[model samples]
Target: MSDSEPRMIEILRILSQQEKPIGSKLIADELNEKGFNLGERAVRYHMQILDEKGYTERKGYSGRVITELGRDKLEKGLIYDQVDFIYSKFEEMIYLTDFNYITQRGNVVVNTSTIYNEESINILKSIIESGLSVSPYVNINEDKSKGKIEVTTLCGTTIDGILLNEGIPAQPQYGGLLRIEDYKPIRFEELISYKKTSLTPLDAFSSPNRTSVMDVVTSGDGLIPANFRLIPGIGREKTIEIIKKLDKIGIGGIIAISDEGKDILGITVPKGMVGISIVGGITPFRAIQEQGQEIDIKIAEEIRDFNTLSPITSTIKYGLKPVEHTPQPKISFLLSKSWNLIQQVNFDIEKRKGDIISNVSYLKKEDLDKTLGIMEETYNSNPKYINPYYKIVNHPSDDNMVGIATICSLSIDGLLINNGIMSNPKYGGLLELTEPPLFIELISYNGSTVDPHKIFIAKNMTSISGNFGPNKILASFKEIPYIAREYAVDLLDTLDKIGFSIYKIGKPREVTYNAKAENYNFGVVAGSGLNSIAAVRERGVDIHVKAIEQLMPFENMDRL
Candidate 1:
């Protein structure tokens, strides 16, 4: 049980005694008089915790009343119910103790709190965004810490009344939070340029599909087929399945930006949802009708058809409310003082990229494993990273495949990184990335190159490959160079920051100029030099800045 466990249970019992909804302030006064000596903060905390799970029935900004569940728990503990640990993080908790003494100064009595979850307590807030309710949890046979029962709500908990795949329940997953590096990131070229035909909407909607809303949205073509409100408690997979069906029927490619501005997709794909309402009629339950006034489905469909900012489904109710915002008060599960363990990556590597020749496994952390006993999900492996060498010039076969490992920067959401450090290999291998910007330097007299630097003091001249100004005489910034003077302007000027820098040498001499704009398709004048990009007639040049960024290791050389 949490340190506040006993007090919380006591608060719930008191609130349940109230016949009508009681204000947070009143609860504080009641607790105070009982010699229990709790503040309004504790009063509100108890109510919030209880109400979130349908235990207490919280009336709007008014007060709270004991709900059936609240009465049940108040009379008989929820001994057999299992809480679906839908949310994974614990650090983001915002603890607020019942402390309302200051509010009584003027008698209005505003309540204050004192909670001790993780700092920055990032509570994974979930609410009903909108849509029909479905099974929101996977219901495994796992039981977490029992020292303190973890009570949770599984009702119509949606993000903003807008349910995606029903509801993204708060189940913690082992190796979840995807360390980004796990999935293969296909480039625009790779994703689009494939020989595989673009699957038609019907073809893309596989019977056994497993993708996200956006994926289905992207594959869709015309308008949403139906407008309906979803009930809470549905799972995300079901929502995705619904989207897949819409895609099959043909949906307009999501307005990369527009939803409320279009027909049949108003306020869709919300960045953040407080709650959701739909225009259509209340989803007729299997056995009974719903409580709220039945909404106008025809109006909603019209709004959707007209592409109004308000989707038809939203006309169903007032803006949706948060799940935790519910009122009521009874709890048996205490979010234990400590959380059940999930998994961890313990690093054993020292900083510094010793030597490339030496076989060194860049990562120095032990591999993580499954924690199904604790967290609810599994982590997908296969970290992706960038391989700059794969795309180097003169290495035509290189693909410049991207590679990098993905890992979460957060520990437990409720617990926070209070006791650990988040580490990544790239940051750990900083020294190797900029070893003085690698390049080859030339010796003046010997004409031999060692250090990655150059002093281009051509005694004669130089010739550049690739095309020139319609075969026109090569002219300097001021005059044509018939007898080019050998001056080391910058040898590795061809390379950019990714490599060495350019330098000059001693004495002035003339040399045949034969330099080529290695990767410039936009046409090169004076400063234009070879780049990481190999000029070709295939695809035209890209954004100028991007081309240059690809080239590095600019060096300088001097001749004898």
Candidate 2:
């Protein structure tokens, strides 16, 4: 046989016989026992080869860890010359969202702004020095009472979220109590708290170090709330196995690797339906450690299985995407926005008989093979449905990415599949929702006989949930009421001429909203839904929106 047996296979066979991956010197001594006369160089060569093949994936540049293939080959005396092994690559770091880079390392700081001062900078430095991770952030909001927070980023800074590199309770949600928003040049005051991890890739060859607080926290039952799926051991195949289990369960996933006796091929997983989660925040966060950075990977207490429904439930929260949301007759400012998002069913088809759907016909693997065999006859035989999503890029000038429009798609069950945005770690699944072009209706109310000279004006557009009251509909233009109304009418006419179709007639819905000229403004509203018209339940998000606007000339809006 060609001495081409995989270096990993040979190393593993040696370890299986000897029970571990050993140093080159020891491996040489052992090979001598087998009458192989393999010198130190030979052993080193094998190690190098194994590492290159990723059978022994390395971390922090030099520390190598064995993979699933290595473990299997070790146990089975995998033939070096011809045996084939499967290889897997770790997911990108941005996708590693389940845990962040914080722990009991006291220096952890969560904030709405940037880190400032010597002490704060020290914490950030410690994070990098700790070797595993250190963090500085912008726009991270937290509300401890209800367990919710919104994280935001202004400059598109990509940093890992809170990490618990130690003992953790099962399925913890770390974000409920804290929220982060993103903005420019962070000021330390906005910083909230963050969970700090103990391990750093810096100076790994040196003796492992620990922080005083980190020791206690990692060793104690410190709360680290993040929803995660755990696999018991390390290896490429086993790593994939656990992920497959989670996939079958239906919830979207992110992955984290637990270091064990052998491997380095750790993968990262982020929260939500896809890896592309992004937030444009108004605040940033602060760092935790001041100095002497060290990663604390101490396991806390053992977690007990609390929720028995792990097997019964398949998703994070039981939410489903509708193939289409019924359109409400858009009359108010808020309703109009929702109407714009509402898509109508255009494909005409009758329900297929359950008889055909039920088919009850058995399909053998052979049948599939035959069907595919026929398609295989063509040059491009593979069905197009299985094709992966192609990513799209855009110019940096887009605001909230509103400058351009992207195609959004969805699965039959309503989960977002893809749309116009690039489907990377931060933009996955979100493809289903798009902010359609802003459309407005202007009615020139030249004061009726019963009422004063009240001119029905328009302006200040916002999200679909914004309202129809004065504050939201652009009252500033009242001084230029004619200009505003004409502008709106012109825009509508332009849209109509450009081929936009109205699915429903208009109606006037009296919406109570704050007003400038008067304490309140009541107005008529008209809008359309996706395929038809429908209404959404009114909530706080409504008044806030109708009350303000952005992008075009409008008022700044938020809930009162």
Candidate 3:
């Protein structure tokens, strides 16, 4: 294949995206915009050759359109001639990325995945919330009649673009599956060098049978798609600084940076070069595929204004609402409302539980204020391990006393129940501090009228005071029907985004973090909502404690 054939192929690609015939001048302009240095005369020469070969046909004087053969050729052209095709496209997108970290403006390259169903959208959002994607921001387009949804996500090459804009000469090396254990990247499980492949390596590795991104999202142990890049040793510090800035603006995917002359994840680095591992942008779609959903993906498909993308949380909060001028199907509209109703019912159940607990247990206003302060301090000290939702209400009996409501582990049970999964509260226990943690003491929630966390706290069974010796924290155990594992994992991920401290969701009929499940049920371990109050009590504050407290609006809760 001649050099001009590649240019003609590009022209065919441009024509494929157009709905009508386009002239050579317009094709030349588009080519130039994409960094191809073709002029009208040169493009006309390519088009004449394309027509002679029957790959494209001239439609009267209007212009030319790609033939059926042209579309096939575009997809299945000579492999040897396109040796570094993906590499070149990667470079082009990097040059095109203009996202300014400081001003938070300009265009960024994005990858789009089109799926045929709505269920996959939720799975994609959960993956984004798990932080496996290049950025948390995403753009979604839904067409219910066609049963299609297009998800546009930030591509990892955008980092390369930013690095280039900052005068750092970074070279993409390979795309691979990065092994993660306990949520830390350990090594590259498989790698394909960019110079050796015409196809996008990450995309080739994105099959459901190949990648374990969903496992990583749920258990923090599995392989995730990632990329390797290298920069000059002198630019190490500057690269790190830029990455920090990107993180501040919610675009995070830089896994690790190697020291000068050092290799990353056992891959050799050339002398005077530094390696950087980045999470691949195709992760969410990879996760969608893992759940047995089919998707058509395009890598580095186009550039869009950064302002047009919204955080993935928005999609989770608001389901596929109709885009402007696009009518939402009646069934789709009903499904969206049903999802919202499920969330509302779950919250209402918890709120009712809290109201019941509040009726019997009331704290003096002074005590309530102090308890809130203590809970805030505990959360501030370690927000990751603590629950952040609470409610304070006027006492029904005494004006001087107030009602304080905190999230209960039973809320997890309620969430599972609302989603059509039967959940049984097994035990409330003292989880001994360890790598995976262990339940040292347990009380049966079915037999006990009082919440077990409250019982354990009153009996001085918990030692979660100063993070010293024999440390134990509050946790609860529940079991869900074994068949509900997949649905439950997705639900737990959604709950995780909304401030639920879910510790571990177990495999079928197995022990999760040392707590066994029933024969046909899977175990779930969650942080007790009363853990903070336990800390307050440990501090010797005079506080009335109620576990499984009724529901409070999550948005109304204050953060420390």
Best candidate per TM-score, number? 3
Q: Which tens-of-lDDT digit does each residue in 1-560 have in candidate 3?
A: 24575687789889998999999889999999877899999999889988998999999999999999888777645333343566787887888888899999999989998998878988887877766778879889998888898889998888999999999988998777777777767777666566634446675465446678888866777888888999999999999899989977878777778878866675677899998888888888888887888899787888889998988773221111111222222111111222333344344332423211111235677776677787787777666567877767777778888766666666667567766887777766677766667665554454332455665676556665574433678887788888888888888877776667788888875556656676888888888877777787787876677654344555455454
Q: State, as a TM-score between 0 and 1, how close model 3 is to the true structure.
A: 0.53
Give per-residue CA lDDT, model 1, range 237-259, as digits (tens): 45444434433322111111122
Give the candidate number with the greatest lDDT: 3
- Give each model's clash number: 128, 114, 4
> Once superposed on the true structure, which residue ranges of model 3 sit more than 4 Å away at CA?
1-4, 17-20, 26-45, 314-560
Weakest lDDT window of 10 consecutive positions for candidate 3: 317-326
Q: TM-score per candidate, in order?
A: 0.16, 0.19, 0.53
Which is the better candidate, 1 or 3, if ranked by TM-score?
3
Q: Please tell me which model should have the higher lDDT, number 2 or number 3.
A: 3
The whole-model C-alpha lDDT of candidate 3 against the native structure comes to 0.72
By TM-score, highest first, what's the ranking? 3, 2, 1
